[model samples]
Target: MQANIRHQVSPYLVFFLIYNSQVGVGILSFQRTIAAKAGYDAWIGVLAAGCIVQVFIWVMYKLLGKANGDIIDVHTNIFGNVLGKFISFFIMIYYWLASVSVLIAFIEIIQVWMFPTMPSWILSTLILFSVYYCVSGGFRVIVGMSFLSFIFPQILIIVLFIFPLKIAHFSNLLPIMNHSFMDMADSIKSSIYSIAGTEALLMYYPFIRDPKASKKFAHLGVLFTTFLYTISTIVSFTFFSENQLKTTIWPELSLTKTVTLSFLERFEYLYISMYLIIICALIALFLWCSSRGLKKIFNRKQKYTLLLLCLLSVILCHFNGSFKDMLNKYIIQMNLWIFYCYIPILLLVLSFIKRGKQNDE
Candidate 1:
């Protein structure tokens, strides 16, 4: 299915799409998780992970540039048709799993912190339906939604973080590099899940008006996400001691509790509401990618594929129990392997193949 010229988004929207995708629920809790592994120097791990992501983005652009198409075409170019379709089918499943995981996770958060009495399935239905609406409108609508997601919450959220400074102990960040190199490396590995979203570019690149011009903007998105994560890590590290951080699940959310306003109490509640916009943007992007993959692999319409995926997401969200946590952990592990290990290997294979073909010419 060729993307219509009327439907293609501008090159610069790539920045918002990549940035919104990367800065999801992961940023809210990543500090504690990484700090648990590397101690105070975990902020270093954030920087390292960002740099690693930049490299992967470069590799992805090179691969896509060679194929002159999306990842489906890349696979078909590298592997034969039958094998490529099989691999792309698995990628569709991977994208579905990612959508389900994000939906369930955000539902759990709302249930725990905002509305304990509300049924999980109700929120799940609402959220999935919203995602379906945006995705069914096509890629341009998804891009517009992502732009709003990036602009709406960012300024207020960053301002809220400033309140924590009254109680922040900058001294908590002292003795930096106190952790062993191996520990910091482990933290970087752990941080990969939080930084995993840029790989979506492999699938969406062909939809951009000028795919080549978007490369730098895409890298800028990664840089922007890295800056946000680094700032969050440093703030969390400064606001809480090592032991305190290890115990806090959502350190960023918890930090909002310290903010006192004249008219509003429980500022975290407002923050959570604002966060739904980001979550919606994330789920929409994943679902769109999944549906588009299905269309490519099976010669089906995206509308039907999107409806199927949205229903599946709602079902998964409703039935998710203790297993939800396990599934999330496994998805993170899969993402780490897929983006870090598999993509690089694929790039090398494509490079060698291109060189051999050039020699034959």
Candidate 2:
């Protein structure tokens, strides 16, 4: 049966999914990682890395769009038959495993920060069900949910600035760039870390209504998300001291704790709830893309493909050592490799062959 490629998503909706997916739980932890390397200068690394990511996004879009297909299709066309299928299989595994690791990390964060007493199985079940629900509806619905979640969570972030009005310690951001250029470059790595979801644009390209607008939408999404990351990091640092910031795991939550209103006490709870929605969308979207990759590689039906992959991912999530251990050992390291080494080389090979074929033509 032919795949259902209807219900095209708008540029705005695409932007929302890309931004929200990239901004997932990483923002909460990244400040410390970046800060540790560059100190107060980490924000600079983030902005610089944001610019570099835009270039990577452009290269990705051009290469993937040349195939007018998903990553699997792109790989197959460039590599051909056996070698192509083998490569596609590796790509599919990489994508699915990455999604599982992120989902597991989200559950672990919720357990530690939001609900210490909650069972891990229960949390994982809820997340899996939510992801399945979104995945079943397809990419357009998933993107719509992303737009909704982005607005509310961002509004809460805007409200958070009010806390910095009184509690902010501007001195914490001093000694700027005290670290060497290499150190700043090192700091920027974490920013690039969370920027994973923008690669979704490749799988998502087929769903865009106006193909001409695809590249513009993706770049704008990157810019907007980078702005959000910078502002949020700046505000978080302003509100907490260097010593306090270093000690804190999730400084964004710490930034929210200063918020007090007549109705609510702990704002982080609301933040966590909204955040889970974005995280769920990210996992669902990634899983959907990975399923698409599998279908292209094996030539299978989408429905059956997704079902099988989802089951496999659910099992993988459960069997993990722990989300943190998985991230530290495998996920974080592997993700960088996927983007920087795997993707770039793949694109370069495609570009060279495509040009050679054009010359022959």
Total clashing pairs for each candidate: 0, 0
TM-score quality measure for candidate 2 = 0.92
246, model 2: CA deviation in Å? Answer: 2.2
Each prediction's whole-model lDDT (CA): 0.87, 0.77
TM-scores of the candidates in the order shown? 0.97, 0.92
lDDT of 1 by residue, 222-282 (tens): 9999998998888888898888887888898888888899999888888899999999999
Model 2: clashing residue pairs? none
Best by TM-score: 1
